[model samples]
Target: MTEVTDFFRQGGGLSDTLPSFELRPGQIELVRAIEKSLSQHTHLVAEAGTGIGKTFSYLLPTLQHDKQVVISTATKHLQEQIFFKDLPLVEKALHKKVSACLLKGRGNYFCHYRYEMFLGSAFQLNKTQAKKVSRLQDWVQQTQSGDLSEIAAFVAEDYAFKKKITSTRENCLNSECPYFDDCFVQKVREKAKKSAVVVVNHSLLMADIVLKETGFAEILPETDVVVIDEAHHLPKIATQAFAEQVSSNQLLELGKDTLQVYRREAGDVEGFADCVEALIGAVDDLRDALADARPNGQVQLAKLKQFKRAYQAFQVLMQVFSEFLHALKALAERSSDLQKINERAEITAERIKSVFSPTAADDSHNDDTERQAAQSVAILEWHADYFKACRLPIHLGNRWQNVMQAYADSWLFVSATLSVGQSFDFFIDSLGLPADIATLQVNSPFNYAEQSVIHILPDLPAPNQHDFVPALVDAVLPILQKTKGRAFMLFTSYRNLYEAAELMQNSDFHLFIQGEHPKSQLIDAFMQSDNAVLLGTVSFWEGVDVAGEKLSCVIIDKIPFPSPGDPMIAEQSRYLESTGRSAFAHCYIPKAATLLKQGAGRLIRSNHDTGVLIFGDNRMLTKSYGRQLIEALPPARQVDSDALFTFIEDTL
Candidate 1:
């Protein structure tokens, strides 16, 4: 077989196979390093910058390797890009037949059982939902895989109607479900099992790994190689996967299900209605206790209104419920629903307990990593009408190490934003990888010096100033005029985004504001418009791709810092401070810089792509940490505000 690295040479397989394939030394180096890592059965951490064809560099080697590879990325967009776009190109380049599958989290697939249930409840929906969902009725019959993304001109994300007609861990009935044989999730899982390359998102990948160990319905086949793209996100995503959460919604559903199940299966069972009444009372009491919660709805348990007292009562209530289930379990054998209800009750009670009571430090493992993993914080969050109490892991460094070690022999972590100034120490240490783990950083094959410039918007007020957002809008207005709104105005928070959106609402150029439309539609509108500017928060900082004249500039509102008010970040910062660490240096700077890099990367996506990246945050010039942030991004030329408009004009 031809060597995988040779596929990148000047007259190599890719050159011959792809007319546009250029010989990139950085791509070749990355491929050679990854191939060596896979062949040797060791761990590797690589930072493959944009325009380096990072996808192909990893795909080619993993495809050639004689092992089943599970490629997990941060987003479904990239997963589809790799499987749909990158994979086929590599296969053709190598002229080798390969099998690949794209498996999303279960909810992405349509549920026949729920669809029928939804049809029954269709009368209750308002006219708008009724109209939108009516389309799915016809499509469901003809669709084979049942993946909603396959449906054109339909939005399935973050829609409450979609949730009601999809499957969740709490709602799924598994083999007992009437539609078991036709389960879309099952079909995809079987596909994933047989394919050599299974592509999944980080959340699904983590869930599968954790679920497989517990002997649940497994999602992937035995994994021989695990390649993590956008690996920087794994630590954050892992904490969510490992954390225990119990919500009022869960309790309410349990009560409703128990009542219905009792009426249908065990009418003679005593205490069913009374137990449900107690559950409802418990939920009310818990919610009433939070009546004085901060308006933002994120409160540290200790700061909550009579939280300690309410929590104590809540714990006792769960205990009583658990006791009721224990007694009920005696008659649970009378029906499978009864048995399942009993089990669900027990699990909910345990989660409530675990979320509230984290274990004290255990001396069983003197390792610092273990000690950090053991530290956890409990938080109360209100979402719309319900609240979820979650136990969040302080850090995932050691826990992630164990997961990677136990799951796959060859572990490869790659991302465009894995390093800060050529040092992968922060990324490595945060992930708890050893210092000796093979490390590689290859700059983007695109020439940043020739293709892009960073224009730090001059004389802007400090971000905390009440008038700062206005200043940002004022400073960037002329640039938008020059570029004619063919730009992305990214913000760190909605405050900035809203302020900018309002200011630009009357501009001659079209405005595609985030939250006004789905991210996909907003991006689509921006791409299709002749003169339009897209305004978005942190979400738009990355994962946006527009080439040629449609996107000629990226105007950032501020340094993209993770909000301190964020419950998880707050708890982690508090924990780090308690251990005498500088949370800003250890936690804040690296994360913010990486995010800034991602935003800057939105420009100059291809070698032919060129644009001006304007930073409205004055800190990029005044603060000491600003230098580090600049270095973290591609080495684009730094210009003062005066010259930036001219640069934009020339580039466009």
Candidate 2:
């Protein structure tokens, strides 16, 4: 058997490469824990901190194991970094003959069939698409590496002809699409079948798990082990993946897709237009109702009743849509084509059923009796929170759970931040994993106590205060003055960001807001400007990486908790509150902690990366739970508010 060290040695033979990796005792212990767990087919969550070279620690052992290993990441950036950058480095270092495949959600690739359909339309012949098609065609011919981010620069239009289609599960047509054989999805899946390791994002991994459990084909059937990186995000990702909500956007898309199908089939173009108008109104009404009902305060059983009213109206719209589709199906001579459309609608209707069902079991039964049973369970579970917990059609935690029971030989979840305050319970419970699941935590290679500074602004106004924004700006200005910009002012709300940016009123710094430009453009502006302040919300917290002098300080306005008034949050809180649990702790606090950690995580990405983490929210010092939040974070030196500017000035 080839040794694990062989892959990391200087020139590339397992034995020849083994000599270079002078694995520190801690690193070796982590590898041993992971290897032991893999050998025993136990679940493990290992916290290999920054500078620990966590990626190599896990990759080396997995490569040596020579099993079909799937490394799942939380973000596409990390996924690409692993597949394109880190994996190659490891593979080259060890000189091992292991094939690695990178799989993204299907929407990343041009759906040839969908594109062809769009081509048949008059609107698609516009200058933008023409240029895009030309560029895409040229790139396709020259490109040996089939990654979509390469073409992301060219395809500037709506990624989701259906929804924001970057790479996702919603639009994946699987075997039903006419262009299945030459599909990029299939191509990657084929590669994954042959490769020893497959790198994918968490959503895709969950999608595969969902498909696998339902007896549908999945991407990792040939895989024996799994590694989930960015494990800190697992809980929230799981919760979100498991939760269900019917948004106006989803309903609108369905209506549009239905109209498109109608226009294509029945030459009754005017009727299709009418259907679209009706759908627009119905979706508008639904949105209006939701907007009127705030998510946070005034929580009563009445809110749920109101949501039901909206849901019922939406259901009626779906029924009317079904009737129209049925009429179209009946009038159509092309049974096969019409059947596909009707079946799609049927599946869409069943989405409600899937949301509430015992999703832990395969609900894709064909037999009359089994189908009936599944339907019954779904019906009974509809109003139950347990049913609502599955974040399917978007995420696949429930589905993955089912699939793992049947096929996965072992699963390894590794990250720099997996545990919360030295506990994996937060993640495990959220992922719906058993409490007894094996887990591990590895220390960081960097000396956090000596490096990063965690500054708590105890005197700042409460986050909800009107003066909070100005005070935050005032508090952060000193730090900014010290560094001369190069900071990320992350906020929980867009309104807060706008308010803070407006108040800062500093012309010396290039102020970039989240929605001002394309994220890439905004990031570029931030990177290029000598002293830039990027004000952003949730998305900026975790995935962003700005090393060196580009980012010197991170100012988090407050702990990022989900807005209480969100329809989903309201419903969740009500459900939890009814169950005799403190919705604040179970629903709100954990979420806030997770997000706070993510926001704080932006401060120290690498060992060389140094910055001041300033939490402008006074709750960190004033609240009792604040200590718990601090304990969950990396060991950073605390700085006095008055001394913060001096420290930054010294460092910069």
For each candidate in turn, the TM-score is 0.89, 0.82
Which candidate leads the pack in lDDT? 1
In model 2, state the lDDT of residue 102.
82
**Residue-by-residue lDDT tens digits, candidate 2, 514-629:** 99788888988889998789999988987776877889888888987777765456655665676697878776777777777777777776667777888887777888988888
| Per-model CA lDDT versus the true structure | 0.80, 0.66
Query: Which window of ten consecutive residues has the lowest lDDT sum in model 2?
Result: 378-387
What is candidate 1's lDDT per residue for 1-652, written digit by digit as tens? 8888888888887888788889899998999998888888998999988888888888888887767799999998889988898888888887888888999998889999877766664558778777766778778878888998877347555476666678878767789888999999999899888999999999999898778668755778887789999998987888777888888878876776677667777778777678677777777666665553433366655444446655555565556667656666676788887887777877887886676544221123336534433577667777446778787777665666777777888989999989998799888867678778999999888888888888887788899999998888888888888888789988888877898788778878898888988788888878989789888888888888887778888888888777797767887788779879988987899898899899888888788888899887888888899898888888988887667767776767
For model 1 the local lDDT of residue 539 reads 84
Residue 568 Cα positional deviation in candidate 2, in Å, after optimal superposition: 4.5
